[model samples]
Target: MEIYALFGTSGTGKSSSALELAYRMNIDAIIDDGILIYEGRKIAGTSAKYEKTKIQAVKRAIFHYEEHASEVKRILDQIQPSRILILGTSKRMIERIVEALQLSSPAEYIPIESIKPKQEIEAAQYVRQTMGKHVIPIPRVEVEKDFLQRLIASAQQIFSSKKEMIGETTVVHPPFTGGRIQIHPQVLRKIVLATCNDFAEVGQVLKTVFTFDDLPRLYVTLSLKLPYGRDIPTLMQDIQLALHKETSFCLNIAPASIDIQIAGLELITTE
Candidate 1:
């Protein structure tokens, strides 16, 4: 298999530009942050961004765990793509991943500087430093299943020069980053309740449950009081949309599921 490497320092926009580079080179797969991606889907391996410490995250990225390394290697062996792209902070880091995965050394090394301007790289660095956001070259839906839901924010879709859809990228803020801010569960619940209450059709938020497992999800049971002539389905749809938008905006994380069960409905009296 032909191997290509993209190298840059940490937070230099390497991950941000990886998909575009792979598309331009016509590469079939990408190995980045311990995940194997093909056609913008994560096929194998867990992301280092899920680790709780920087040291552990680094180890994961280089495939230090035997099981993790074996999993990715097995997939690569089975599929056997013609060409693959590897991303890393340095040439040595790329070499480590190749060795751990038992893949051949990269034949071409592309520097991040060649693809991104200095100002862009600086801006990426600033966001990484301040907001603690990391880019994963996979769609948000795929990421929501694999990653901790609290860490995932939004999906970014990239298009080619001809306006063809290339791939989707996810922005995440892993807990391993130092000085990163945390959103309290109670605060998040309150935001959800408030958002639900904002809708004229919603009477009260009965109960809210937040699950923080492999994927974070929210379950809300609420009562809605519609106008005598209002459509129930339409009002419920509006509530769902409003709840999703407000909750995602406030938490900067996507919930794997937002289940709004209407417990009861009351009639609004005309004045």
Candidate 2:
């Protein structure tokens, strides 16, 4: 069985992408972010909670994972001779989860992040304001109409069709008022990591399809504008080392000679 984890940060499209990829790949089931989410089915202990305390939230989250992990493992054993598990988690969470699970094999790990929603909304709104005048309408629901009629019949609230122009109008949905922009920190991180995944994917294809010792050289290029952190290079080194130690096959894994330039540093956080 093979596990493919769809990892990303909050609202990073992990759930949506996981479902799509699982359908495309026809994987038996998906262990989404440590939760066993099967196709068109719901499992227990997978509830969305907006806890206030971070520590409490973390503890509750761990409990939920433990509750479902064994069941997921059992399901993997009996059905779907070949299984792919996709987990959505940060790098730190992934390390802890893998260690706790004692997984001997390489399980795909993806790191998700986001910058800030305010910045994204501001950018989107700016574009919309500069572009043109537009407004999106939200259709009134039938239930509201029915409730209005009932209220009129019972004399609870008076109903009348009154239309008086108070001021100028525009075309666009209120919810979509903030035009549209791509400036989420998490999105930025996703873009950066997507390049890494692309490289890994290409290497995977080459190793599988070619399956030869002397393979054609391939190069992967990636760019990121972030504060210069030693972690970036260290992370690259870790990935290369992991690949070298894990794979024992015909294909040789080596770092290509290319440019790994850091555009700019935004912030520097130490661990």
Candidate 3:
């Protein structure tokens, strides 16, 4: 089978990107943190996340146990998928998994930086370092089957609301990690307000609302001053992009939706 590898150092959001990357590339299965997932199903193998310690977790992730490797290998042999995506921290780690599973070398090597921007990756790493939460491309319910219910932190279905995007993702707290670091709504509001104030065109921020239900969704009610030659639509896009970029850089997140309400418009004056 042809293999594709998406690798980055720990906490760089490799797992966070896996599902969308797989969908984009049309990969048939995903092997992440020692779990074998095919067609949105956990076919075989246990997650290394279930381990109690980091050393043990590393061993499990690399399929150190003969049974772990054999079970996944046997299933692969039976199913014989044409293409598979492997998630790892490095090329060497991918090599170890391929050797463990008795599979050939990867036909493609995709680094995390190749797919993710530096700002986004740093934000993801910051989240990992601070919050200790990790993402798995598998669905929350399916992954939780091998995990205690308490370990399930949250989940988001992959990509867009568009129908043919068939994947679910789980955000988990591995047994080795500590507690979470939540960004309160007030903090988020301040950040949004600050971003708006930074723009010369914004006259006032009337109100701000930030929601974190399934994904981060932001709403801002504001009035703006019209610059000499700039249209409202272009300025709106600029505000949305700035908000998205600022949130991603500061909080390691991009909102699912950012709605900017223009309450009032006044023409700018140069005295």
Candidate 4:
């Protein structure tokens, strides 16, 4: 069987992107989180998300349970899909899943970074880290058939599929890592100030403001000290890049927009 792998860090939107990738590649089936989803329906295997602890969840995700591996392998053998996409948190994890299922090595590996935009990946990680929400790519079916019969339709946030309609998707909080994470606003502000001061071109940061009604937005006013002929646009672009990268690193959330205004410029001799 031809196999393709999609890998990313936990909460980096791998599951959210799985159905689309599968549909785009014309894959016949998907193996994710220890479940066999075929033709927009789950065929066999237990989801690791339902595990009660982190260790148990890791075991389930890697198909550590003999019965779970056997169940999925049996169905895959019966269906004999020509092309399949396997989603995992990392290449090592995918390797483990492949080994446990006795499947051939993957012919291709697609990283989540290639599939999702930097901002989108950061947003997904923010939701997962702060609110404990996870995107599960499974179409809605009769509740009786669901492995977690307890989760009602009302509790899930579902999105309709594309025209090709690989499968519907819902946001869920996996039991193994479910909880709320709180980050102080002051911490976010400090991150911005520090990143700005790191630039040698910046003379002084006159003002900094952060708005957090929906997505975070940053407004920065600065005085710059540059050589007589320094390129202004390129310098500002560099600072913007640092702000996004640093803020995302510290808080797992990047501002939707950053507005930087130049208040003053002290041009020095290029000589």
Model 1 lDDT tens row, 114-222: 9997757765765676568899888877775555565556556878788877788888888887765556778977988788867877788888887654345678888
**Local accuracy of candidate 3 as per-residue lDDT tens digits, 206-261:** 99997654345789999888756678898889999999999988886677789999
Residue pairs clashing, model 1? none
**Global lDDT of each candidate:** 0.84, 0.37, 0.84, 0.80
- Cα deviation of 131 in candidate 3 (Å)? 1.2
lDDT of 1 at 62: 99
* Ten contiguous residues with the weakest lDDT in model 4: 150-159
State in Å the error of residue 186, model 4.
4.5
In model 3, the Cα lDDT at residue 46 comes to 87
As for model 4, its CA RMSD to the true structure in angstroms is 5.2
**TM per candidate:** 0.64, 0.35, 0.66, 0.73
Q: Global lDDT for candidate 4? A: 0.80
Better of 3 and 4 by lDDT: 3
